[model samples]
Target: ATGNYLDDLSAESHVILTNAKAEVEILKAQVGDYLQFIRNGYFCLDSKSWEQGNRVYNRTVTLRDSWAKMKQKMGL
Candidate 1:
């Protein structure tokens, strides 16, 4: 009876450990997915910021050219 009880306890412990390990793996996968999502968002935002900077630079250049043309025409 003692040996049988010990065997049952060991089997139960093994089952619990297996379940815990599977749960940990699932949580790890979820974390990985979230991290990748954050990385993608960061890249998207960075690209948008760069595009905006380019737009501002182009506008500034256009404004400067127009100003130069106006001054030349006005004999300044």
Candidate 2:
């Protein structure tokens, strides 16, 4: 009877440990998903910054072109 009780206790302990391990695995997966989300946000922001820089570059090129045309008309 004592041996049977010990076996029951061991089985219960195994079930508890297995459940804890599963919980930890779930948390790890959540953390991984959060990291990916943060990385995606960073990349999106970087893309916006690049787009703004390109727009500024295009504006500068347009102004330069206009200046050159004005100079040509004045024969300078």
Candidate 3:
């Protein structure tokens, strides 16, 4: 879950996440490739979409949380 990722991040983790946008792109491609070889009849594939949505959601929450904390600290 996106909340889990946010809660799991530490200062060191945030440093690595500076390039999370790029890393998520790589992850998405890998996911797609994994899906390609599967022709299972019951694979709704909605889970794949959900994973991508989580990545974007994480990206947004990460930045937005940073901004909110900064604004609060600045009394803005």
Q: Pick the candidate with the highest lDDT.
A: 3
**Pairs in steric clash, model 1:** none
Determine which window of 10 residues in candidate 2 has minimal summed lDDT.
54-63
lDDT of 1 by residue, 6-55 (tens): 65563433221122122343333321132122211211123343446521
**Largest TM-score belongs to which candidate?**
3
Which of the two candidates, 2 or 3, achieves a greater TM-score against the reference?
3
TM-score of each: 0.18, 0.18, 0.21
Report the Cα lDDT for residue 19, model 2. 23
- How do these models rank on TM-score, best leading? 3, 2, 1
The residue-level lDDT of candidate 2 at 13 comes to 36
Off by over 4 Å in 3: 1-45, 48-64
User: Positional deviation of 45 in candidate 1, in angstroms?
Assistant: 15
lDDT of 2 by residue, 1-76 (tens): 4667765564433221122122343333321132122211211122343446521101111112577799999999
| Backbone clashes in model 1 | 0
